[model samples]
Target chain A: MTKSLKTVQLSHGGGGKEMDQLIKSVFFEAFNNPILCSEEDAAKLHLSGPVAFTTDSFTVAPLFFAGGNIGKLAIAGTVNDLAMMAAQPEYLSCSFIIEEGFAIDDLVTIVNSMAAELHQSGARIVCGDTKVVPKGCADGLFINTTGIGRIIYPDVSANNIVAGDAIIVSRDIGRHGATILMAREGLALESELTSDCATLWPIVEQLIAANIPIHAMRDATRGGLSAVLNEWAKASNIGIDVNESAIPVADEVKGLCELFGFEPFDLANEGTFIIALPQAIAQGAIEVMQRYGHCQQAAIIGHATSAHSGKVVLTTPWGSHRYLDLPQGELLPRIC
Target chain B: MTKSLKTVQLSHGGGGKEMDQLIKSVFFEAFNNPILCSEEDAAKLHLSGPVAFTTDSFTVAPLFFAGGNIGKLAIAGTVNDLAMMAAQPEYLSCSFIIEEGFAIDDLVTIVNSMAAELHQSGARIVCGDTKVVPKGCADGLFINTTGIGRIIYPDVSANNIVAGDAIIVSRDIGRHGATILMAREGLALESELTSDCATLWPIVEQLIAANIPIHAMRDATRGGLSAVLNEWAKASNIGIDVNESAIPVADEVKGLCELFGFEPFDLANEGTFIIALPQAIAQGAIEVMQRYGHCQQAAIIGHATSAHSGKVVLTTPWGSHRYLDLPQGELLPRIC
Candidate 1:
């Protein structure tokens, strides 16, 4: 009976003895905390005042990625959401849906990655649940993380961007998207091109500590920079004019986009983000961000305007302008 | 392109135009609320003092089940977690992982079911995310719900179960597990056997409102009544003596268990719960629970004792005593 339990079986998620053993030996040992070890139905917490709540289900393909794996993404993804809201991430709930026969070793590796990533934001996995499906019923594994944090900076909204606000890209665009594309397509790159899938809490915390009047902040995930700019334009009822030449894109990302007929602005990004603030303080924000290695390439890419409300206008290197619309069709699936 | 849009496509989860349309027309319309429509990265909440946080992932096979579908279970399961802690269910985050080519109509049905279930506990889905995987990579769909609620009563925990505490099962056991088994095995029982899938917040609210001194409360979900009792025994360092005949088991469940060599006490349940309270208030708690139609069969099936600490002793109909250990092996997979 013990021999057959080398890999996770249906019994491991059945809330029985096998499940108890797996949770204790794996999850409890990795994510040890007072609230979690209490074994209550729900984790008791002492959250007060304004809190930020968010959820994300990570289904990134090729669980082991170039820079990080799905477990790292799961923790950082949800933690970034709270950070984007200018909140200090505090608590998270991690749930897993595993397919039967998934290697126990792989599961352990993924869980350990999650525990390591949690330290990046000082967040705790306070509560969780697990479900397992039969073989072929699900891909190797999928993780869902829900996070809550205290909102230290309030009134930061997509609708809060004003006409004089400046747009800043945190780092080089499309590295994450291009990295995943390369990984999936088996492309061998000469340079050390990896995913920008790091936790943004450090940089975001720095910005708040530096006292930048941040109007809006968001990670350029999923629909990428173009989607974020367009949504901001529509939500804040302002026109956004971006300089095409100023937005930084890595050489490898540019090469992949050209080869795959994808736009750098249209692909997904896991770790990169966009920030909007009053133009007077934009340079200060850039200086604060540039102190970090990941944000060394941060630059002012655009500005909000009243000319073309509900739209984003891109000024090309040739001094001609065109609308940068929201991305329409599927570019890459399971990028996150 | 429109011709192929009858079912959910990969684009619906691509974080692009199609994904936006799907969210607006499907989820937004069904779960319409001010917080959700705000379109922020994280929903801003005003939770104060003590709060209860919990999460559950639902991957039930046969999305359309006997009494409820996966969506209903998703909301109820998470809400019940908070309710079990004597918390007032308030806000929830819903995330979905969908398989490509899953029926759009079925997805809508599940979403509607989720919206209906939210009304039972007055919990709003404040934030959500949707992801689509390629076909055959996953089953129909899986849902993860994380909830936060204000604690109305505190210190209700498994460790608080003291000697002289009466243990009561909210309703019949094994119905959900048996129903799923019958569905999977193609058993056409003569009796109308449906799962005991339901939202327990309404009944739980009544108990708390009546000021019952509850020591511990938990829903018998995965490992059923036996698991709950065993955990209570170990956590509180008290022996649990349950009268085997007093436990309510329907005729269909008993027949199925007898035929399949399964124990009714070890089967999964969705709506059923067990309460541990002082014997002085046990009758009052029962009266409050029995007010609901689903709890008509609620009975005091056990009592916490000092004898044989850290174990569960089950007295058979012939007065023979045996240790009812935590269940081992997989009795049912994806039962939730």
Candidate 2:
């Protein structure tokens, strides 16, 4: 019967026959697992040790994007939060607020992308809820994913950073923010830029296995490299000095930032992350990241300092230094 | 700076200064807890044993209702799902997707309601996220809450119902649905009706403490009593028989159901729940519910049977029997 309908109707989320059918045919089919298939009021899980819990809501416009879609971002974003805490991601709960008359084909594509992304972290979607609003009440769709994982490397924390700790970037930045701008501005045909929206669990897992002794690890998601560094500086009550030339940025992203008058440091990155560790082991960590984690562009961009506490200073290529403040106003809305 | 603006701006969700100020003043101030104040990517929790996890998204139109707002419903809905599994509501993660230009006063009121509701189950909002969409991209706001708790009574499940089990209703039904309908229709001044929106943990805790052998337990949410009963029958592969006269319904609910030509059994209940237990303990369960759960009208309305497997048969007051199939199409959208 669902095949007879081209789009999702209000009845599909009415908690009745049509709702059950849609969940079984779409969500259950894509995310088939014993825990979810049990169909209880809540999922029963066996958890122990220090558990890391986090949540994120994705309202990215144009659900479909160049490199990934909202579904992929929803999964990767929550899983990456766990990974940032040096946790082993295990379970996730997904809730969808869909608009009436959304295309069933697009829903399928999104669900399939979610299923594929889950494979990167070995996390299972255990329980979920669905609701549908009238057409004008919502955009296309919004997804909220909450995740739980066991903290394997328990010493990692933002406040743990200290003087002499080297700051490292996982990869090139600003691609995700620039890509979204391009998509929204109808400049998709002008360049081949794509969002760096990949799951970071594999890379994080390797670093943990290598005993990197990371002090802090965080994904540069919403406010990019500047946000993470500035937060760490304020949280740790220390100063951070960066060699601006060491920070990686793609040419297309740089060009777009220049054209739009946006800073690359303020742009967002879905997959890129920053790390803080002892300078003695920074080179070793970078080597492990490149050799085993496949983060070929990973580099030590900066280091913690005792001067100018609670501030982040950037050294330009011409040897001039300036404060890299936390982004103040709206950079780009719904970039995630 | 935020005091100057009466409404939320797109910059408040931009992951920068304005967003930080809003979060600190609104969410952090109300939900002040050590874990949440730690300012980490994920909250670290020590969860042991079999954990119950559930998620729900609240998109109830007319954000503020007679009895409760979306904030109260969001917390109670997810907490009830865990309580139905005989779990101790412990940690919760909340995510908000707000539309731009929404009133700031309304947002503060909603957050305060959430903080008050969390006290009902002693659950803490350990982590959360906020995202804002452009004006008209979404309704006023939507809240997603995901909860996790340790299962104390692990035997409760929808598939655990068996032959000769008594069916009980915790309280009168259809109040929440009727109340919302009345609100949407601008008839709030005509009657003194209120939504039965409440946290069910206190009642469920009393039942567990009394050692009532609960075979299956579930909240009567969307699709209402009929949906839960039908799902139980199919899951347990058993038949259920209900005496229509034994069910409880408020006068206002009955009046509204008749006016709208809708079955009371098909209307949703925010706080009411269904239980399956042995006939021998049925009277004791009702006593516990009434004395401790404050369920004045709790009653045993039906029993599970071996005949007519996988179906629910309701006996009318006039002595006629008919199948109470699941609600087929959309009854009311965005009721929760």
Each candidate's interface RMSD, rounded to one decimal?
A: 0.6, 0.6
lDDT of 1 at B16: 79
Tens digit of lDDT per residue, candidate 1, span A307-333? 989999999999999999999877899
Q: What is the C-alpha RMSD of each candidate to the true structure, in Å?
A: 1.6, 1.0
Task: Point to the candidate with the largest lDDT.
Answer: 2
Model 2 agreement with the true structure over A1-336: per-residue lDDT tens digits = 675689989998888999999899999999999999897989999998898999999999878888999999999999999999999999999999999999999999999999999999999999898898989899999999999999999999999999999999988899989999999999988889989998999888988888889999999999889889999999999999999999988999989999999999999899999999999999988888887433789999999999999999999989999999889888999987
Give the top-scoring candidate (DockQ).
Answer: 2
Docking category of candidate 1:
high
lDDT of each residue in B35-57, candidate 2, tens digit only: 99897999999988999999999
DockQ of candidate 2 compared with the true complex: 0.91
State residue B252's C-alpha deviation in candidate 2, in Å: 1.1
Evaluate residue A22 in candidate 2 and report its C-alpha lDDT on the 0 to 100 scale. Answer: 89
Model 2 regions more than 4 Å off: A292-294, B292-294
Candidate 1, superposed: residue stretches over 4 Å from native = A1-5, A188-191, B1-4, B188-190
Docking class of 2: high
User: Candidate 1 at residue B117, lDDT?
Assistant: 95
